[model samples]
Target: MCNEMTTSLKTEVLESPLEIVLKGSNTKFITAFKELLLHPVYSRPTLQFIESSVKLAPNRARVLAESEHGRLIFIQLLKQTESWYSGEDNFYLHLLNSIISQLLSADLGNLFLSTFSEPIVNEDERLSLLKIVDAAIDSLLERKSTTLDCQPLLEILFRDFTTASAQAIPFIRSADTSPEYSDSLLSQLTNIWNRLIVLLDIYQTILDNQPSLKPEILKDNIIEELVSLLGEAQKSLPRRSKLADLEKSASKSSSGNVSDHDDLDPKDFPLIKGKIIYLLGTLVQENKQVQDLVRQLQGLELVLTNCIIDLNNPFIRERSILCLRYLLANNPENQDFVAKMEAKETVSEDALHEAGYETELVNGKLALKKRT
Candidate 1:
């Protein structure tokens, strides 16, 4: 009966989207609204109806989320809209975002997020879904959205990231094979890098909205993995940067799988590294527990090592210094650990100067260097 109603209404041929009108809450109304959205003109009304219907109340949203009719409407959204639409003012994109936000705020046993957490075979589909999920998380944070349960949702996000890391790190290893392999590695790395970008963006948004959750975020011993990954990423940077140039020299090849707008360049390691530093800094900022966590993991150097000039990553040096600051904030152990860290051999002043730093002398002796 439900399928029949949806098929009949969606099959209606209308000259204008304005022809459709949403009436009482019923199967026919839901079906007609799905068809109406096919034309962009009725998108706003459709979005409004979804916001009111699925998000009528948290309880109602959950109940509806469980209902066959509600599930059908939600499924229609995936078919009707694309999450990749750009611009701040696109209603089609806004509608997609609004729907995810409402579902998350309702949180029905992490139903909305759980769908995303599961393994997705198609990389493009996973990336698209992740983008929508990221947008939804932004809305939740903006509204200070709460739900009956969020830990499950949070855990799902973490798990999804773990999955992404597993998928991407193997590709990162391909960078070490040979210089000639640069083009293929860069193409492969884009998918991984783009996925990391959104996941990191989502994590930053979550922590930004609720600074108090920092301890909770670190309590799971996530810092250990993060520190290890940061080390892995740093190790890969110089190699990948070199490979990028080698790739450009060889050919301007392209990958059809990745989006052109993402500007997925091979040498963009600094961007990913910088984001990791920022996320770590945010997590450790004014939070003694996470600060100590970093100290325990011996990850302070990950941030400090990045405290150098890299033209590719515009503000990465500053971000690295800031992350170190957070790592050292009121933590004597971390401060001392950083203080004791030294180069394998003594550095010459000319070398420092060439690296864009002016050495600062303690009395008559040089103790530190600052960016000139």
Candidate 2:
């Protein structure tokens, strides 16, 4: 009865009048609301109010985040919600995520960074933090993918951000774009890539502190998609090299849209492939299910074959080897399977040559390089 009365009070009496009222520098209201959060029944509606208020007036995110009572409310709510967090989709979790997402989309990411500057209480909190960071990465990936029309990434690409950009430029048949626009687009894409790395670094820090959560983090199925991304990046490379030819085709055509190839290029992203490899390595390390999943995709060979020196990947060869070690460790079937594979025939090099390639010496050994 009390809960019902409180809900009614929130909906009827407080709804309109309190909406504007709450946004003020009212310490008492924030403190009292924090108390309501301690009650299960009232908490949900209260948090909903918080999210809705932020949604209605985006700047209130800073208002809510920076204030002492407001900060305590969020922290208390975060702790309180753990009791009911069933998975990534629970209501409380989603509400919290919505609020955070709103804040981030508003260019208020500094708030989250500031939140992290304080000491984290424990692993659960840190894991929550990591998953949240991953979500932010996903948002960036989504924006980045908008360029690819690719589903984008989900593919492993090289370390140097430029390689990803180079791979992407041809999609528009680079020759067709104004040099200025391409440079501008290139700059924007590089900025997005840099932000992604910063978030990934945050992920690494939390994971380093609580390594066991790697598999838990993998439950999102990042590996399956990224391995798929690798295949797409590799297969697309040949096609990208041929993108210049599309200009020839376009010149002959009367109809033109965003340049079928211009939708997004795999190389538009920087250090994408290397990032993909590193993320997957974290996911599959010491996890049999993920290892088997990679093995099943013929991903084992796919990965091994690409383990070559590429400037875009910097230490790609090394990273790939380490990832392979993780894939094979303690899993004898994968071990024996990999052991039986011929090093010379790991992947069909014919595809690379067909795409166009040149041989060169690298660190004193001859290596295949895409023809510049």
Candidate 3:
């Protein structure tokens, strides 16, 4: 009798439609199946079933992403397997991972993007979606799937950064007056920054591995916008530092003792700053036009200043040095600018000319080179 019951149950599961199992009103079945889906022992078979179902009917899968009941299930599963990416054998996570892989493989980039971008009402739901998106991106990058178009995803990620920065800037500027509000803003900002870094790293990785794709990626103006944003953030750092010092002095005078206000560390902001510099380095590594653009925009100077400001952060320092190295690699004009800026003695135009190299405007920046 036990053997017969087990056989019947397996047959029932195989015959049931995935959509009904996922969004059905049978709470008992849903709850039991959810448990089974999350169980490490039973997850692989369950996930394989789901993957095959989705592959057979992608429209139904997309409808699931669009439906509230389906999204809730995804959110619940995502929360339950928060540590899934750490090599844990959670079935629900495996199922979701497999679904994402299938979607990318099928060249359903727009569907995935649209479904994931659904307007989630809850903050936790939104964050859960973000985490899911991040995992999907990692999987996509790992596969190096050539058929997948990353441009749309890149635009969405860049928009996320710009939107978050716009919201956080007001609070950042007025942080001295409203500490609590500023803390909240900074928390949001940090989350967005972390996501941006992940996305940018993925973007850089794709560009690095595929040389032919550079034209497609660079045509979007994403690099120029990123550089502009980086300059704006760097400009605000000193002002924020000065404001912090003033607030510290005021607190000390009023209390007649140095208040241990270690709540916010100015150093934390440099991690974002460093990531921006590193990304700039990645963008200009092989492109001479971009290198020349960075020179014209005084990006080199901004990077050099950051090297000093973020000296304690080895990763930042290393990236800054690499950026400088790449920027000056085949460009002598930028090299001469560095030399002139560093040297105490004034180097005349005549001296540059006498060195068998004359300054010529290349892409609107003076470059030193031998007369051709």
* lDDT of predicted model 3: 0.59
Per-residue lDDT of 1-372 in model 2, one digit per residue for the tens?
444456545655356533444455655555557667777667787778878877777667775556555556666655664565654648777777677666666656555545533353232343344345455545543563322111111112122222333334344243233344467666554444444444445445435544655655565555665676565555543222245544655564546544433444333443555666776677787789889999987777766765665543445566676677677667766755654453345533443343344345557644554456
Clash list (residue pairs), candidate 3: 333-367
RMSD of each: 7.6, 17.2, 9.1
Name the weakest run of 10 consecutive residues (lDDT summed) in model 2: 148-157
What tens digits encode model 3's per-residue C-alpha lDDT throughout 74-186?
A: 55555554456556555556567667656655555455555555355333344445556666656666665445566555566565556655654553454344355366555
Task: Flag the better candidate by TM-score, 2 or 3.
Answer: 3
lDDT-superior candidate, 1 or 2: 1
**TM-score (C-alpha) between model 3 and the true structure:** 0.65
Score every model by TM-score.
Answer: 0.68, 0.41, 0.65
User: Model 1: what TM-score?
Assistant: 0.68
Best candidate according to TM-score = 1
Which candidate model has the greater lDDT, 1 or 3? 1
In candidate 1 the C-alpha lDDT for residue 254 amounts to 52
Q: How much is 112 displaced in model 3, in angstroms?
A: 2.6
Sequence-dependent TM-score of model 2: 0.41
